[model samples]
Target: MDITSLGGERAAPFEPTFASAAESYLKHGGEERYLAPIVAYFGDRPLKTIYPFDIKAMAEALYPSQSNATRNRQAVTPARAVLMHGYDRGWCNFIRVRRFKEEKPKRRKPATAVWLHAFSRQCDKDGLEHLAAIVLFMASTGARISEAIALRWDEVDLTARTALLLKTKTSTNSMRYLTDEVARRLRGLKEGNSSTDRVFRYSNRHSVNERIRAVCDRADIPYKPPHTCGRHTFASTAIELGMDVKTTMIAGDWRSSSVFLETYVTPRGTPGRVVADRMNVHDFGDI
Candidate 1:
């Protein structure tokens, strides 16, 4: 009977415009680049009034010539994140935007051992042992360029053949054991370097990649980016050498087996040769 007194007066509704929500999201450390187009598209629209179709339309209008992956990454994903941030603040209902369909990508070939060898030789010829060591470290340990660049001497244990990856893309520290070759190279670099110093002298990934591209060009080898030459090559080569999927995943710090298998474990260098040799298959006439 006294429900009105019990409930008291209803509070004013919390309504935030998309622009304000996005501004709040950015202030809370959200990526600015992704939210830029979304803000420009929706401007001061109420967060609650935006729908999935509106977001999709925004993506289409903003990125007409871009691929589905680009649209989703730059548009759909960021928009959803901002809306979710708003929902968390009780300014809007939670919303889900279906991503655009992406076609299956063609398999990328990892750098071969021969290609790496040539690349290393060129680096050595140019008196760039540090560059050689960088690629080798990446290829041996499946470290990303950023991880490799961020590695300090103290994080490495040559005796134990392990390095701690502190700046991993996964946002977790990872321990990666080095191959004997990588360990030897690290030892050589350690001689004159302080434990407090970074293992490589490079300041950024772009410079390293540019140096790699230059070396590849001089070596007359096809240039693959650091990701392809290092991490991708490590995974593919490890599996090709008969390392088990689980072991490879652990070594590469791949959290998802499906992603590792589908994206990184591509067959390379006459994959059917071993089977063909074992089966002894021949031409029909010869048979």
Candidate 2:
């Protein structure tokens, strides 16, 4: 992988300032999301001067102002990108940068089936069929809104009861199961639709949120959108119904069981009772 011969005798050594490297790697290299934050932190420093400790400091600095997800994306992603860039270019050896440990946010309760039914009925009443479909799909599949919006008819396999999600946050296509309810709604929506067509047509998340708020106002239920409540509901319901962790993780496309447990799955009355009943077995004979 030596590039020395590519440039010949006049090739300069591969040394870029942090600003130049960040620009080249984050912006021009196509991960523009991290550009501003990385530049703001170490824009003027030399790339060679950056150490693991510097990354730790950057993460610490981000703690007060940003969420753990945002902080990691800002500080860690760009650093790794730059370091990997240097390695790929044959200019520097591998450098390890420690990322900050993010505290798992408290689990949000999923939207109840009752709430969803009321919301959907309200949406239909208000002529928001599209929004209702979106909510129903997310609640049924545990899909993120982005995943739902990016879905296509071609990705859905009705016979197999699965959908291939190509535009996921993980940058990898995921296969999510389709419930009978969701499949029915999706089938109705896709009637006379082409494979290339998007599943739902919407302007943006903001508009969707507004529509959801209107539906909630009419339904007389709390306005927790499917992104929060729907996903939570999917996980919690799966656990409550005794679906295994691995199965739930695969269906939801969660990378790890720990993440599924800590973030998405919130124990509720039924599961709590079951766990308590199981604990009785471990009790020392009524001691």
lDDT of each: 0.89, 0.76
For each candidate, give its TM-score against the true structure: 0.82, 0.72
Clashing pairs in 2: 110-233
lDDT of 2 by residue, 168-211 (tens): 88778887887787777677778788998887777467777888
Highest lDDT: which candidate?
Answer: 1
lDDT of 2 at 200: 75
Worst 10 residues of 1 by lDDT: 278-287
Question: Which digits, one per residue and each the tens of the lDDT, describe model 1 over residues 255-283?
Answer: 99999988898886576887787576566
Clashes of each: 0, 1
Worst 10 residues of 2 by lDDT: 26-35
